[model samples]
Target: MHQVHVVGLGVDHRDITPTASRLIDSAEVLAGGDRLLALFNDHPAVKILIKSPLKNVIDRINQEMQSHRKVVVLADGDPLFFGIGKRLIDAFGKDAVIIYPNVTTLQVAASKLKIPWHDIKSISLHGRKDIQPLLTALVGNNRVAVFTEPDFSPAKVADELIRRGADTFNMHVFEDLETETEKTRCFELKDAVKQTFSPLNFIILNRIKQAVISLSLGLDDDLYLHQRGLITKREIRVAGLSSLEIEPHHTLWDLGAGCGSVAIEASLLAYEGIVLAVEKAPERIQLIRQNISRMCAYGVEVIHGEMPECLESLPDPHRVFIGGGMGKDNSVLEAATERLRPGGKLVLHLVLMGSMARARDYLKDLKWPFSITQLQVSRSKDLAGDHRLEALNPVFIISAKKPALRL
Candidate 1:
């Protein structure tokens, strides 16, 4: 049987290559969306309008191929990039289909922006309502392009971003790319929400101040609002987080999440993950929410209740951070360890030696693979006219990993 030709009709019908045009013209059967088929109304080929219930179209294409009839399928933009080309190839063997490539909408958007696209990230909200993946991608990326759908349009995206406290990005919207009625405009994320955009549009987000998010582990203690000096020290937070071994998609539990520094940092590291910060103090819960917004750490969810009790409703965690309450009641630790998914890691920070010893004994009793480190952090401070080091309180950090198989 002859191979079916799948042509990418760039942005406009005029953008179709001469070779592709000939393939379309000489085909005995043609299939594409209504709009695409309308573009070639003058063609004498038997046109099949592609629609929902994609299986019907597939069946028709298979029948045409079985009959040895020449068929051409029209696709918008480059078919390989989140397009129908791959689906067709997957259904029919690769050798049975010929793909003619063209400039994708992403490429056109980048070209108009006059920016390098090799380093940029691309996402399609075409049939997706979940923005979690997009939010995760926005964590450290400087440039991103999104293919918008009618339901999840640019304005919806802007609202989501604003809700996530991601005000550091500038939005550029491009509609009807490469056409006479095409429009492109840039706006601050705040203003983007107030504006209307066409459904046939894509969005490019450029970081306004790239330096806001950094790779460093310890953010300044002043960044969070805490009661007295109850927050986790910067050095200890850095030490504990380093040992937690956070992954991009891990669900983390931050017990006694005072000021939520650890959870916030974990949110950044586990951008695609969920971080539940269980803080009983009403004031602290408010502060954690504020800190999350300020840091643009949208992955964090503050639970305004005590740990162990609060953890009941949460999904199993891949990692757990016990920065508080473990010293007061080892039950929190026991609950966390019990609920931690197999092969997950748990890191605990304790300031008191008694609490440290109790935690060590509890971990040892469980016979889980664990280690303890004592951190003595000293910071340089200006005293008189000379710089002198001031020793902060020493803290103990305990880390344990759940075995893949229980004994």
Candidate 2:
């Protein structure tokens, strides 16, 4: 079988290893981007330009392989490090592909700063639409390296961090790595957002200071920026989240999310997952954003629309929490329950006895096993310079799980 050789050209062409050079020399087909291909413009071989809708490139490579052509695919840095090597490996099994790795941009960038990179968390925003990965990367790590794309530039990344109030890190942007024109500059996230960078660039974020509020399973209600004490109490929030049985990768929908306290904490629990906080009120939507920013809850998405309607465009959820928006009828509850994934859990916080009865009846009609926990919390308050236990409004926690599919 003719094997395809994927070579990483490092930062400079002069650094190419002798073995990679020999493979490129013996190639009957050369595949890479226009910039990389320009290095071997004089070489007499069939050229395949790697372009968008990469399936075509894969097909052409497969066709050339059938003809027993020696194919050399040129790439930058380490081919397996967020490059095209995986695609080739997927197209043709690992046995059919030989990889020659060179020094990566991250290595060079870290070397210039004299910083050890093994501890650094690296993520690529290249050709990616969601910044959740980047946000999640910032959760525990003090340092993060990012491979930026043209559309999602360094400035855009800084802008996003600033928007989310997770901009505690200093931004280090490296431009044109390994070239004489290479330039590296460090900026505070606020300043980085206003600056432009070269197309060929990467960024590093180093946490400068601890966030004002340390995130945990349950945060005090006073820490959040809710309107008129409209946020979920800490006790009920924890209990409701526990009832959802959230996993690290579970997608959660906080329907009728008021002030977004539950959704914010849920995002922290489901670190690798997404949380959609659907709220119809504009004021509460703003409050949710403020709380998300304050808490540095990176994965919670504030969706400003009514339940059942907004739920249509969202992906199927692994956990559903209905805190409000049940309306005068049970339409929202019915809609949320029906949309829960098989074996997924649904939790609701209802203060009204009438609403709780309606929910019970709905679950009964569907023959779904459900449980309810009446949560009553009390906190001590100062009464005339002395502390006294003050009772909070009682809440009914209802939880149910959809049955898994049976063969």
Candidate 3:
């Protein structure tokens, strides 16, 4: 009959606005979570408790609407924001529902902390076990807010962040916001992982001032922990990374990721994306982990496995860097190119002329347009009282992009 009114009650019954209170008072049918429905125990309206298997709740609302003139659904915070209001709007046509908004829990959390949230990244872990997006956001953003779920609780989130070598953040947990039991506490990531919090909570992660890493592309080779000359040279890495054309949210693969230099640098560039570094050597894998922590590149993941084989299990890439498999077979290159997303870029670094020839022929056969650059870098070395330039080995850098449409 009449349009259903969905009201957002901030934290409790005390948060109901005058208009929401009037609507609830006159409602012939009221529906909400048990906690929300219980707040209006004195109301004479027929109350329906919102439950899981949400279809049942939708069914009840549909049935009640046939007999009632006024049906009101109660929601927490802003109804449209990760709330049931969207479900109602989708179930009924947009014209059949009217939504009344209120400040969201995230807004309150930010307000309580006196932090400006316009630029903060907000993620909802409710009913989601995937932590990748959260981790990605945490890597690139200085501030983030997360809505917690039972399975992916605040402590669990903290654990995941710490496990990924993210320790430079200060975590703020707001529990029972705006309610009698409201409690807010802030802790370092290490301490946050050890403490349990109320299920009704949100977490705020603010990166520490000193934890910010430089945005420059090529960091000094000496800054990373690597075996004797096993790392990608700074100039070569800079040239290769530039060719990769990394975007902020592009998933990248660093095959033969020696000390994860390319992946770590790409992670900084693609902070909102994931960089999978597949390295075969266990020693190098450890080194990659250490370098990732050193660079604060939380978005880079070090996979302790060989290339071509490890490529299958990874998410399809928007870009790939073949830095370590130069002298090896061309199968890794082929696999990486095939898995690249449409319009994706692939960059390869080769020290051997034969390897470069093989890669060039492979790209030619695939009909992929490509470019090659030879990098010859000379660095100044302190010798006795004079500085002499020492030439590093020349590297061949090849880059190609997968055509967006099949030829």
lDDT, candidate 3, 18-97, per-residue tens:
99889988999999988888888999998989888889998888887876558999988888988898898889889988
Candidate 3 lands at a TM-score of 0.81
Weakest ten-residue segment in model 2 by summed lDDT: 290-299
Q: Give the Å error, residue 141, model 1.
A: 3.5
Task: List model 2 lDDT by residue over 251-358, tens digit each.
Answer: 899888888889888888888888888999998888888777666676788889876687888888999998883588887888887788999998989898988998
Residue 39 of candidate 1: its Cα lDDT? 87
Q: Give me the runs in candidate 3 sitting further than 4 Å from their true place.
A: 1-6, 23-75, 79-99, 111-120, 140-142, 212-215, 381-388, 405-407
The candidate scoring highest on lDDT is: 2
> Which scores higher on lDDT, 2 or 3?
2
Better of 1 and 3 by TM-score: 3
Cα displacement (angstroms), candidate 1, residue 109, comes to: 2.4
**Ten-residue region with minimum lDDT total, candidate 3:** 208-217
Model 3 / residue 385 / CA error / Å = 7.3
Q: Write the residue-wise lDDT of candidate 1 on 1-407 in tens digits.
A: 56889999887668888998888889999999888998889888888787767788888988898888899999888888877888888898899889998888888888998988888988787667567667767766888888777788888899988876777789999988778889999998888888888767888998886533353468888767788788889888888888999988899999888888898888778877778889898888888877766666766777887666878988899999888756456778888899999999999888888888898898889899999899998999998999999999888888999989758
TM-scores, all models, native as reference: 0.76, 0.87, 0.81
Off by over 4 Å in 2: 227-229, 366-369, 376-394, 403-407
